[model samples]
Target: MFRIETHAISLVRRGLMAALIVAASVLIGATVALAESHGFAGLEGGTFAMGSGKHYREEAPVRQVTLQPFSIQKTEVTNAEFAAFVEDTGYVTTAEKDLDQSDYPGLPPDLLKAGSMVFAQPKDPVALNDINLWWRYVPGAQWRHPRGPESSIEGLEDHPVVQVSIEDAKAYAAWAGGRLPTEAEWEYAARGGLDGAQFSWGEDYDPSEGWKANTWQGVFPSIDTAEDGHHGSAPVGSYASNGYGLYDMAGNVWEYVSDWWIPGHPTKDQTNPGGPSKTLAEQFANSAVGARHVVKGGSWLCAPSYCFRYRPSARQPAERSLGSNHIGFRIVRDGVN
Candidate 1:
């Protein structure tokens, strides 16, 4: 009787384990599908309308951009989303890589120490021109620890991932069988179906009355009144989404575009103008002097007094090696799922 009972117990344990594995896989797939719910369903004329503003005309114009047709994550790849990827691939991010002091000229001994920078509500005012004011060089703010080593995403599974380097974004895309969106594709999708209008919705910069894209809520740098229900970043889809169902296209963390920093828009109608052949490793007369890469969308920190890239056409240059709290990226997969 004892021998028979032992064999039965073993069979029951194996069956339970098999059931748990099946349940876990199903739960994971559902989670991924839920995450991508906001991306473009299709490309067609719709409610959103963009106009050739100074920024648009300067960088992009009415041109033919033939996309191969790909599915991108509806919003930025959030902290929770990145954590999942890191846990699975055991991938170490660029910031996680140890930079040899010999590589960078002014890199301080502590600078080479492993960690990333994150934005914090400064107890005092910081000069926007002087980056050190707002960007805190916090140790342990990687994918797992966004705010700091002590911080966690316990309940914020949908907040856009920040402090991710281009290298980090690229690795996640590769692991997901996807890649980064080109500047053109990012613009097209962000436009949603809106024709030419000043902003994503229309000419005015109102977040109410059908223009719920992300923009400055209160005063630029000094004060964020949180008028539209967000002081920093609202939930992934807290505000209204563009026609393509993508949210936080305008104000949030600036997104990484595949193209390098190249002056001037396309002179001719083009199909995915593969960005600049080489990125300019020159000093930006405006921002920090370092490797230049293209960034789209204005972050929550943007205000009239400071950065005002609240339009889909607006673009900016970011240092490649630098990953700020206001910078992140989404992944794109060629062909629909």
Candidate 2:
């Protein structure tokens, strides 16, 4: 009788453990499904002047463009959203993968560890021309560890997930059943129904009162006044949304677009302009072989004296494989839903 009772208790405990495992799996599945259903704001896309003649050279030759109706995430992808995707898919970011010496020929073997570029502010004023003064390539600096191995996403669940390569962004978008926004689509949505405005909100940088976005204040690479109440990335929707009810379209982190980087805008009017088809190799034949993608909307590091790219027309090229703390992405889906 004693032997039978002991065996029965063991079987019951085993059954309870299996049941708990099944319950946990169900909870995880539910969480992933909930995250995949992120809200998107619909835009009645129409004709708009795509580029700006007043800003950088790349934005020149301002041309007209027409776009189909689409829906885009109201805010940039947050850390919590990305965590859910990773949990569901077991996806590993490029920054987390071991570095290939073949891709970085001259880099030392010791420096070939998995890592991502992180923004480190200098103690003193530095020259604006060289970005190395502020950007540091720290090992283990993936999205979860924005600064380095010591850092974490503890209180940053609501903050935009940074240090994500274009490939990583594409993977997340795919899992979410969406795609990265085109350059024209991103710019059009960023405009918030306002045509050819200098800034996403309006013409003035700091109109009437205080800072409207998370852009840097004071000096670049050295001091940040934090006039916008944030030194780095602010929580999504921390500031006011634009005319079309989209948030962080001007400043926060530079959001990646689906289009590749081109030197300048097209002269002729384009219907849903999708940028050039030429590979990064063809476009940068004279330079390095690595191709780059277009990243729009300036980051919190953008200052008036240095990178004044917080405007809607602003754009920059980011290397395809590299991820930086100041770079992130949002998703868009075609149709009016």
| Error of model 1, residue 59, in angstroms | 3.1
- The lDDT for every candidate, in the order shown, is 0.62, 0.78
For candidate 1, the per-residue lDDT at 326 reads 75
- Residue pairs whose backbone atoms clash in candidate 2: none
**Model 2, residue 133: C-alpha shift (Å):** 1.3
lDDT of 2 by residue, 1-337 (tens): 0000111011100001111111123334444543455478999889999899897888888888999999999889888778777766666777776656666566666557777778889999987766666777787889889989999877777789998888889888998889999999999999998898998888886435866889888888799988789998988888888898889998899999988777678799999878777564246422443456789999898888878889889888777767778888899988977
**Clashing residue pairs, backbone N/CA/C < 3 A, model 1:** 39-74, 48-194, 49-194, 49-195, 50-195, 50-196, 50-197, 51-197, 78-161
* Model 2 steric clash total: 0
**Runs of candidate 1 exceeding 4 Å displacement:** 1-30, 36-40, 44-53, 56-68, 123-128, 208-211, 279-290
Instruction: Name the Cα RMSD for model 2.
Output: 13.3
Best by TM-score: 2
For model 1, residues 1-337, the per-residue Cα lDDT tens digits are 0000111001100001111111123334534765657553444322222224365334555555566566767878766567667657666665555555555545566566656767666655556665444556666676556777797655556677776777777778887778888887777777766656555565676455543754555544556777666776656777777777777778877898887765456555665456665534243223334345678877787775666676777787655555666788877776665
Per-candidate clash tally = 9, 0
TM-score between candidate 1 and the true structure: 0.78
